[model samples]
Target: MATELNKGPMLGQRHVQSFLLFSAITVNFMTKFNAGVAVVAMTDAESTNPDFPEYDWDEMQRSYILSSFFWGYILTQFLGGWLCRRYGARITMFASTLGSAVLVALVPWCVSWGGWQAYCALRMAMGLFQGFVFPCIHAHLANWCPVNERNRLGALANMGIDCGTLVSMFASGLIAASSIGWPGIFYVSSGVGIFWCIMWWFFGADTPGESKLISEAERSYIENSISSSHKAKEGHAGTSIPVPWKAIWTSVPFWAYMITKCCQSWGFSTLQTEMPAYMNGVLLMDMKKNALYSALPYFASWVMAVVYLIIADILLTRNIMSITGIRKTINSIAFFVPAAALIGVGFLDSEQKTLAVVLMCTNVGINAGSTIGSTINTIDLSPNHAGILMGIANTASNVIPIVTPLLVGIMVKDNHDRQQWQVVFIISAVIFVVGDLIYLAFGQMVTQPWDAPDFLDKERSPNLQEEGYSKALEAKESTNVDEAKRKEIEAGLESEEPKKKALNDEL
Candidate 1:
């Protein structure tokens, strides 16, 4: 591994793969949030550019349009996992982005022909394709990232979400106000998506072994590191292990993670989808100011995500915390601090616009800690099945996005009413607090028994099975030791061989 490292550049092919994944996520989310900004120009008479057409959508209608993406999104999460496991992340992500681009281009015509209902249908179609993205990304990272570097590389990839949201919110406003008008938002986003599809098709890969672009040295380093960590027999190329669905469903830690995921989704969707409207209605900000302020929070979020990554690496490399402790600690900060800031935001009056912006930024920025926390917990629990696990969790969590806007529509009858918006913020805060508390009580970062079910057969005695598992891990780790240590381990194994053979004969 040292020789391989010396032979390659300081940054390897894996870093290139990470960068592409980051760009893929950025493009995907740009399309995802484009509607949030464009909706202002589409509906509000005051905000609409004179050159563009405006629709008279009521609050309920607007809510439907914003929430519609999750309708089809929910249906495909599990399927995405199956597809990724069966095929590969490279093709799955490529297909998703290409389909989403085509659908985005059709948005203006759909809305023009049939109004909000047609627009909702188009968004739903886009959701079906885009739903595959996250599962594929998780699976890809599991294959490409080393155990030690997981948090840093994972953060780099996930930060694309914030980058995408920032660009969409900030740039969509300018595009909408240009000579091309509201339709320009869809056009520009679609064009970017298409361009990304071209790049991903040429460069994206599922694993280091499969990539022609990767050096042999880097590939050996990644595979050896991952194999040592996972301690499972690597299967043949183009095949997958059977999913332990029953085991996953029964796991306590998985359930805890899922519940927190749902809560985070509810709060995140509420803010991501409705914040522009909040700025327009409550703060009375115009289109340009609304876009700029809404985008600023995500910029803070992107920056804070990097900070969280750095802090997490310090705690890990310095041995300041156990892996479980690190996960719980980071997750607690991600949830509790944001919950407090959200509640604070609710109490501010319209005159406290600057304070409200600060609070909202705090809420969103600190929330980025989740990327290093529960977001990557699926990978920790079972790297081999991370994609499928993500699929299951995402399917349940994304339902909250569908529910949030409708709930907001029912609660906030008057968009300009500060009291109603206060109620919405408080509810989100309560949910966030409750979910993190559950995770604190029940969540774990250790790999579960079921992660390698084939190795630990049900017929084995529990104590014997656990002892054997430890021995196997020790054997794998022995390979990385110095020659002196390696010789000692070999001698020890040879000494036990006669007893092992005698025991086997008796059995």
Candidate 2:
């Protein structure tokens, strides 16, 4: 019976297992960086091989090819969020992971077919599948991990970037530099993705309570924590506004989250896609060395974020700090660190290449704050409704990729000038500082609907008023015992029809 009971809803121990499983899947799903990891290895071949050999290639053309993924990613955010809300996280993850795998497998063909055009089309398709991955992951984690444990668990999934980055840089670099040509790198990475897809197909569940193998003790613990939420027996939890729209559109917290997300992405995306090329062009890094420098900043960001999340979550759940207070302090620390590093990046001009790399590493590390401000806070705002919030924010912020490519295109003087690259850094630094200010001033971690006067607690059965009338009782709004009694009397008196005496009988 206990085994049978665990498989019904979002609050079971099996749900916890499902969350853990998706973390692994998510990490595997995002490592689709053939552009960054395999590029240097393939470039010479692409330039020389008869099929794609000898095209006029430089940093600008290379950047455009890489930026193509964002176009597909941003386009899918809205639809993906809605689908995750409607279909369930497991289905979306299963589909997205498989979709990306198919697209990745097509990369070598793109190289052989139309070259850059083929590469661009396949990358856009990769982006489409990839867009749904984040929102769907957010939906699962929101339900599977209780609020207090949300960030560490979220960090666990997010730590995929590190895992993926490590594989792409260290693993792929050695492969590219060795006997395997650039295409061999994708062949290896794509295998990891396909394996994860099979695992998800067999094991992934939409919710925890729906898992078959959860222990009773673990299920009881999860139920108790969420008992105050939708898992609660009645009222607010049951009446939860469909989709958490009231808070999402109207609350000050939503914008704060979105701005911080954009700021963080603006800074982080620069490193992931552009930094390698910048090092090659401006700092004079060769291909093999560029892989590590390009890879280091992301490595640092991932580690720092994991440490911050564990410590902060422990403090918040233990009542050592309020959500807003912890958010302000940690985000400030995270922001200032990178902001300071980026401020120095403006000084890079080729002569100070070593100093420039140090500044770049420091600047990139600061963006780890995104996990705290945008990613983790979904739980704080409303655990039940977090997934949709993540979707809305993702859809909004990913525009950075669209805007950034153009910005860099316009700024770089033929892609080699140090001044243009420096300008992009300065601009990123300003966005981060401005975003930090918005979150510090206006963001709140949670919202309560009953705080409004007109809001009816919807969990009451439809017959409450009719039953109250029969019992000669007032509506629930009566303020005190005395008021309740008086209102009851007034209600009874008004409710009764007056008896009429005939006029003829009185005469």
Q: Go through the candidates in order and give the C-alpha RMSD of each one to the true structure.
A: 13.9, 9.2
Clashing pairs in 1: none
Candidate 1 per-residue lDDT, tens place, 57-173, comes to 999999999989999998999989888877788889999999999999999888888999999999999999999998888888888887788888888999998999999999998
lDDT of 1: 0.86
Among these predicted structures, which one has the highest lDDT? 1
For all candidates in order, the CA lDDT equals 0.86, 0.67
Q: Tell me the deviation in Å of residue 402 in model 1.
A: 0.3
Total backbone clashes of model 2?
Answer: 5
Candidate 2, clashing residue pairs?
7-209, 7-210, 8-209, 15-208, 47-54
User: What is the overall TM-score of model 2 with all chains considered together?
Assistant: 0.79
Model 2 spans with C-alpha error above 4 angstroms = 1-31, 44-55, 227-241, 244-247, 349-351, 448-507
* Per-residue lDDT value at 419 in model 2: 72
